[model samples]
Target chain A: METDLGLWAVPIAMLGGAIRVSTPILFVSLGETLTERSGRINLGLEGTLVFGAMSGYALAVMTGSPWLGVIAAAITGALFGLVHGLICSLPKVNDIAIGIAMMLLGMGLAFYFGKPFIQPVAPDLPAIPLGWWSDLPQVRAALQVNVLFLIGLVAAGVLWWMLKATKIGLTLRVVGDSTDAARALGLTPSLVRTLATAAGGAFAGIGGAYLSLYYPGSWNEGISSGQGLMAVALVIFARWNPIACVGAAMLFGAAGALGPALQTIGVSSGYYLFYAAPYVLTLGVLIATSSPTQALSGAPGELSINK
Target chain B: MTLPKFSRRTFLSTSAALAAGAAFGPLPARAAGGMTVGFIYVGPKDDFGYNQAHAEGAAAVAAMDGVTIVEEENVAETTDVQKSMESMINFDGASLIFPTSFGYFDPHVLEVAPKYPDVRFEHAAGLWTEGMPSNIGSYFGYIGMGQYLNGITAGHMTASKKIGFVAAKPIPQVLLNINSFLLGARAVDPSITCQVIFTGEWSLAVKEAEATNALADAGCDVITCHVDGPKVVMETAAGRGCYICGYHADQSPLAPEKYLTGAEWNWAGVYPKMVQTMLDGGTIPNFLRGGLADGFVKMSPLGPAVTDAARTQFEATKAEIMKGGFQVIKGPLKDNKGNEIAGAGEGFAEDDIRLESMDYLVEGVIGATS
Candidate 1:
């Protein structure tokens, strides 16, 4: 097969790669956004993401349904979050340290349990061929979007709305703003943060499910590649806003797609440099957004690390 | 702020002294009174590719007499690997250790080998030098021959004369496989051109899939790869309806419909032999190299997608390779940049060190190593 699509194919392929790669990041960052908004940071979401991937893949392989695998992943992720939440809720327990410990636990458990699920091919999540209207093969292949990506977009919108328009959102916000204020308002800060962390973990887990059951569609140790950690940075970049997380994830995805996209255009020189695009973009984002004198204006007042 | 800081030279000397002391440490007594061999893998045991190939070999040796196998999976090629080796030595009392990843050769294996001179160390796909410790050995198979055979199948299967190669890195071992595959394909169809994409990392599943899709979108009817795991590449190519030739292990099960064949490591054939030779009081060669005749590497069974003619050709090539006269990286070769690698009348021997350090792609290969 000799494709003569030429220069036009680069952006099209990149667009496709961006959608495929960003789905996980979108889910994870959205999850991180919720956690950070509730005055907790779960750095162990990387472990959650990996465990989710392993659980999702194993369940999908066992059940022959990718959706069930996804649900399993979400549940597993939520459980990890719950553990992190409970452990950190104890007096004098640092959330950051607990998060790091949980992350290791999640990864260890996943690696230990994911041993048998490595080779088996699980049912893959389906993709919608939005590119059917295109005459060009490159365009058509590039436009084949997975269903999870749409769900992620909807999740972003719903999360954004929930954060602004609901009583639960107000209570969570009050809990995040000040524990004293929450106590005065007769709210349990620990319970609220724990639920938020669990919710965040569930979102990260769905991202993991997307990795194992959708795009790359396989279970392995290297599947996450620090995307879970990157989502933490992404949350900061998004100012802990769920809607902005979608945009940030897509941007990261586009950066990641840059190398392969250039290769299609016959740009092979210095190819390894292009693989650093995402990391470079992340550094650039941090440099642009961070102010040394003060925390980013949108950071919750009760967020201990910011102090 | 009040802490004392050591000078760079002082720090270096102290660390060097510590390493040397650790290296020349007194030998610990064996507890089990039997041969215990340890195998460390950089990936999962069932990655269906690179690590799995080694694990299979480990399993082969595990069944041997008086041998206790202590296996550690997901061991990275960093200082962390040194800890795993130490644990295997100090805890499991392993007399032999196989740190199988390519990157484990330098600091990790070198650092650990001297510490336990009594223990034999065999690293896979390593470049061992004269200056390295005597107890350390390197073993690798000529899997490029299998790649060449797989290329022949791809050449016959592809109607469009365009093939895709998804590679982990542009290192010599990977480049050799890519070039050999292209050479074999060109032997069948002179006009066949292979577009190669390097994913930079050994196990970036997402990049592997994207590269496969990009290749398919570019009209590459046939695809192959040299990544740590071929699962992503194989599945993506099959998903994109492209014929695939896998690497490291047989991935036909992943994409049976679109699978053409694969170049696989036959570590099972050599691991037992190596261990048995050592058990029988024979020295394991410092640099062990084997070819198809020795059963170090073998081609996967041809898939339904492969034509009968391609199979016949593959069999003939296999027979020739087994007869000990086949050399894939022969002379009369020119790199893709049109530089003469070998003159028309000259070629390197099968075990040529030049092949080990191969830096350029052969003619008909489309990609830059840089």
Candidate 2:
């Protein structure tokens, strides 16, 4: 079983790694996009993501079904989001401050409850084997994309359409663009933002499911290396567009995979620098796209950062 | 990844245990003179990895007479460990503390040791130079010898003649293991090559898994690792149908069929002896090091996948190690870059101080230290 494919292996491995790694970020960015689009920001998705990974892995182990674990993760994430949303909707409350608190609260709860789950082995989500026609093992290994990624792709498109043409999308936009405008149309801004934030949390939870039930496929205290927080920067870099978020996530994934992919081919120089590649890319993208003179394009008017 | 931190509930529970132990734990022979010892870990004690090995040692010390062991798991290596150490001394009446994590040695233990000169702090895998405080000591096992044994089994079982190592960092201890694994395999078959990948962190599960898959992809039939927790690497290798050798603790339970052999710390053998020496009014060494011959490290039971020839070689090698003066990094050795590490007839014995600062991979390894 000689797994080497010479120079060809690097790109193929990176391509596969990119798709696999990007799924969680894509799901998270999409969730963040949803929350931000409704005139709210849930920095607490970091907590939601970790909690989701814990609950998802725990359920999958107990039920022997990965899908149930994903459902459990989403439900838990939604509850976390609901709490965050409820607290932020009150008078004189800062969403950012509440979000940071919620992040700690969510992680603390997960660690406390996730203690017993550290050792249990959960069933992994199945891969689609998109490279079934390939004779090369590298191609086959690279093409073994998980089903969550496919859902994420559809999710990005569905979210794009749902935010563009639908009446629900119009209401969300109206609420996000201006609170006074939404009130003129008899829309409750807090209610809209709360539900939207919850939905966003559900998506972030699924991203966590992708982490513990698919790629890394285990529950531990260190399972997530701030991929949840990275999604915040990723969403901003994508200009708040769901479709763009997918591209940005893949780019970040490729950057993240650059170090290991190079190591596979015996390229070991600048190894530590590669660990900083994704963060570098994020900073580079943010710098190139933003101006000191104006707010970011497509940014929600009622979003706290914009204000 | 940031190591797990002790939660409020965990801290409270430890406080309760410390208070209870302080009040009631007394040996009849030394009831008035019993000493309280504290052990701190950077992760959960049952992680089935590095922390677990240390925790096992702490448990062994707990069973000894005239010693009250107070353990606080999930203490970060930050200034938080300083607080834990202070609490152990001030609140729990501990005079001897073992901060088991490697990172705890630096500023944390150094800062606190001088503050409490009467309290002895023994850190694992830290370099204790002459200028360091006398109360602060360091002890480490030469577990690379255990990895060498693992390589012997891997070399025999490997069908591809290419073994793989998934390493957490390119530090001295990890580099030593990587070199030793290759040297051990090369002793069995001269043609064997060990490909190495550094994940750059101690507990990045995603990178560890990817590195294992990448190694399996590169035709490595047997994989071993030097990571904080070998759980992800072992499971990933086993999942990919590659034979795996574990590190830090016994991981045969993770991949029973694919498990070959592993390098494990026999701290339970080392810790009790040190504590017993301290209890006997003897001074513990400031700088302590040992290997298989000294009962500081041991190997996991050879899995069913290992052959009789491998078993014979492994046992013979074990006996040779037990006899002492066994040199793994010896003559005719060139680093991967063709630079001479030792002259054609030169060799460094297992306990040589220079080996502790090893900074290069052996000739057969495929990765760079940097």
Candidate 3:
């Protein structure tokens, strides 16, 4: 589909692709928000994303209900994170390597479960046609959004408030900023962080399920185009703020949509190079904003990745 | 429309129950416990390629007597394949299981088969996976026949003398296809070159598109893909104003302009026959490689762009194969190195091609394996 960028359609396509792109990131970054605030990092969300896509798509096809498939996916993802949490709960297993192993295991599982779902039309997700609000033809095209996209927006706001205002959030942050501080205050660092990781894992699973159950329903080995890992990268760019994560996720979305947008507008040259927009934008953003001292900048203390 | 969020998409319920030829077949369940069949696919059924074909086959079975099928797409790796298998057997109560990927043969199907001796497993692509639960069988189409015929078209149509072939992985089955396609392409134009690109993974649209564009830039006018998804070779070809033959399905929509033609596996026609065979109290033969004659495989509709000469030639080649008169790797075949393949009318045995764990490339195809 050659998106005509000059006809005011390019922006519409970008707006549409932006939401499509942001959904996966919203889920992953939200999960990361929970993780980073709780003093841990599950760098294995990429694997979780793949596995969730596979499992969710497969299960949805099997049961004939995409929602059940989603639930099944969430459960699988939580279990995956639980394993990560349990592994990290013990001493000496680097959460990074364990995350890596979990990633492999998650991807492995997704591939296996996804076998039969390779066929059949997945039940399509319902979209809210907010385009009706605008009589402009372009607005209609631009505003054809999924309910989950809106839910993601709300989720970002609620999560942001939770981190800033809730006691659990404060405690988790305490444990994250300084396990010693939490311990001095009689708080359990291990418990708070473990729960956060599990929550993050669940969100990652939902991110995965979103890919299969919504934008492109049904299972396939190639269903996920690295949305999970990109979400993780997006979290770093979001500076651990769930609200900002949405904007960052959408920027990445716009970048990804640029290639198709350019091709859509009758300028098809260098089309292959357009696929690199997200990575290029991502690199540009990180270089522009990242503080030289990881700790001196937006990074939370006690996160294993910074160290 | 507050599109009430429902979780899954259900194809028509499969009311399928068939008699079991083998002793370990499904015991006739009560009116409620009819036949339950399970399927494992390599990609989402909606992928419109490999898994979708098999799912349609399974759905066809569901359309028949007393069968209830539960299909799972996007099964992760072998371990999870085994998990999905086990769950189908123990939990979903599937009497028959089809793991539609060749990769799932050993680690997944074989590992789970012995545990459920009462259940039968029909696996795709496991020439070796034929043994299991005394009831397991393997099925494959002679797709090499279609690939060879498509080659006749490729050879006849290409003016640039260059053909591009994109593939997913270098497994033996895929390797055989590349060999057959090249062999056919060379049959018509001996000077024709087939440049191959490996996407490393299956059905990845972006990578497929990128690699395809690079090939097109190098002046390859004719293209083909063993990979899944319309987002790749088909779309890229249409956008770049090139021609391509599709695999697995009639992907003409993606490249209506450049659609050259493709080979499609008629699992719908082939699968019901297998179910009937099981019901008729007959055991499936080992190493069953079904083809056009057997109705497991068929050629897709030629696209508008495929010339009459090309179609006519391909049709003739296809007819010969259906008659069991054509052999791809038969003697007078020379290696790309100009060495005699078997020397003076010697042919590659079914073991060499059928058990075909081939690594060598035929003449006219160029690429390297890292």
TM-score of each candidate? 0.93, 0.94, 0.60
Calculate each model's fnat, 2 decimals. Answer: 0.70, 0.57, 0.16
Hey, what RMSD does candidate 3 come out at?
Answer: 12.5
lDDT of 3 by residue, B85-126 (tens): 876765567778888886787667777777678888888774
Q: Compute the interface RMSD for each candidate structure.
A: 1.5, 1.4, 10.1
Give the poorly placed runs of model 1, Cα more than 4 Å off.
A289-294, B1-33
Which one wins by lDDT: 1 or 3? 1
Model 3 has a DockQ score of: 0.10
Q: How would you encode candidate 2's per-residue C-alpha lDDT over B217-272 as one tens digit per residue? A: 77788999988888888888897789999899999998899998899999999999
- The per-model lDDT (C-alpha) reads 0.87, 0.88, 0.72
Q: What is the C-alpha RMSD of each candidate to the true structure, in Å?
A: 4.3, 4.5, 12.5
DockQ leader: 1
- Per model, state how many residue pairs clash: 2, 1, 60
Per-residue accuracy of model 2 over A1-307 as CA lDDT, tens digit each: 6646888767776787788789989988999999899999899998999999999999999999999999999999899889988998999899999989988988888888998988778899999889899887767777888999999999999999999999999999999999999999999999999999899999999999999998888888788779989997788898889999999998888777777777868898778898788899889888887789877888989999988
Tens digits of per-residue lDDT for model 3, A92-183: 77888888788878877776766556555466456777879766544554565877788889989999898899997789889888889999
lDDT for B137 in candidate 2 is: 88
For model 1, the TM-score of its B chain against the native B chain is: 0.91
